[model samples]
Target: MARIKNGILGGVQGCIGDVEGFIRNGEAFIRKRKKKSTVPRSVKQLANMQKMSVIGEMIHSMTSFVALGFELISKNQSFSANNAAKSYQLKHSLQGQYPNLNIDYAQVRLSEGQLPVAVNPIVNLMDNGVQFSWEIDADQSYDRATPRVMLLVYAPALKKSYYTLSGARKNAGTDFMELPDSFKGHELHAYISFITDDKNEISNSAYVGSIGPAFIEGRNEAEDSFKAQNDDHKDVLTTKSIEHKDLLIPAIITIDDIKPEKVVHTKPNDRFDKRAKAVMKRIKK
Candidate 1:
């Protein structure tokens, strides 16, 4: 493929007899038109196509969450964020065989990184919304406490998701995502991950538990992590509840817009809270 230059022809997006011009991710390009293949697809080839179709369909709806999860890996590697996400799902999340293929939600990972993941992660449904919590270590010698949480909840029946990109600090141990009215009486699968306060890194997500009416499945005894902490610790943690009610939004991507678009933050320091900045400063000391 060749890029359309800034000239008389400028850019094109259609076939002009012998040449085919197109725009991908807003970049214009041209290539020679080729005749359609006349050969039949082999069994193996057809199976691969089916796999890509199913996986691509699932990835199409959650590009926003995928962008945050795969941002670091995508930037460091050759693949784009959406492509990197699809590649991982294709290799790991699909279940059954070709004709009977499906996505195993339990195995689905929204984000991947070298950062340490949440220990003993859990999720609970409350009157306000679904709250996600994780065990916080007291050790503060490392760069572990300040990364914000990424709460992801998928409703299998709805084929859509509700999530937040930047949430409470890991040390805060908990965050809430307000659900839409449509989520009433529906089951949801929850996953939690972490992204650096600077947005430079992320952590692999953990499937906390599956939610149902008054019950949780897949978790040994999934309850709000808040219930297990010391009463004194609760006092400190409760004070750290940072409201991101606005960021708790749903995602639905169009089929044509297949590429993952990067979400650019205005300025890192502007988003950092005073408390987190103080904690980081003290930890670095």
Candidate 2:
């Protein structure tokens, strides 16, 4: 009887401990739920989260190798660090002459607190080519002193791409590019980017949607032949051949003399005379 009473006490103690633990966890959860955020997370803030951290880590790792190379080159007799610095400046100077914007993120900032202006391109389909136009007034985010446009056109079916550069001022209204006949019936996609003259900063690419020639049904040679031969008959028709060789075109036959299916032995003088008399009456009238 004493052992049974001890067992009951042990069960009661275990239930009390579990109840206390549950109460503490519930209170902590309630406290967390009561905490309020000052501002809701914005799209840009969410996107920028960990962006700088990853970029800084990548730059740090790359700079270590680049710095070591530069130090070793500084000690070398053939190429010094001063020479490398001058070479780098010269290379960028040459690049400045051209609208050289390969990667979109590589674009440098123009001024303090300035970012690339988003551009909306108007893609037009022409009879023989395609045209691109954008409203310069819409780009009010950054100051564009001298603007350069990069147009990229791609044909997925043809697996071909064409890109060109145009000055925003020169092509004020619209810019046209002639497409090849092979681009017919294939979908073409276009993207446009702008570069600033002072900073050579490239803007984010704006997808202009699919722009290309209209879909045209090309003539199928095999279908054409089959349709022509089987138009009015159910029998499978074969191309005419002289012997066993297939001919592109059948030979034409011309006969000078005509033969009737059944020749009548009756005299033709009576009919000829009646036709002559009728002709004379009409002429006299």
lDDT of each model, Cα atoms only?
A: 0.73, 0.44
Q: lDDT tens string, model 1, 1-285?
A: 445466666787678878998765555677889987899988888889988988777777678999878888877554678998889888899999868888888888889998899999988887647888889899854578888899887776677778898899889999888987666667788889988878887899888988865223333333344334433333443212222211211121222322224222333355556645665565467
Model 2: per-residue Cα lDDT over 123-165, one tens digit each: 8877667788876564443356345665656665565656555
Query: Which residue pairs in candidate 1 have backbone atoms (N, alpha carbon, C) closer than 3 angstroms, thus clashing?
Result: none
What TM-score goes with each of the models? 0.64, 0.34
Which candidate gets the maximum lDDT versus the true structure? 1
Model 2 RMSD vs true structure: 23.9
Model 1's TM-score against the true structure: 0.64
lDDT of the structure predicted as candidate 1: 0.73
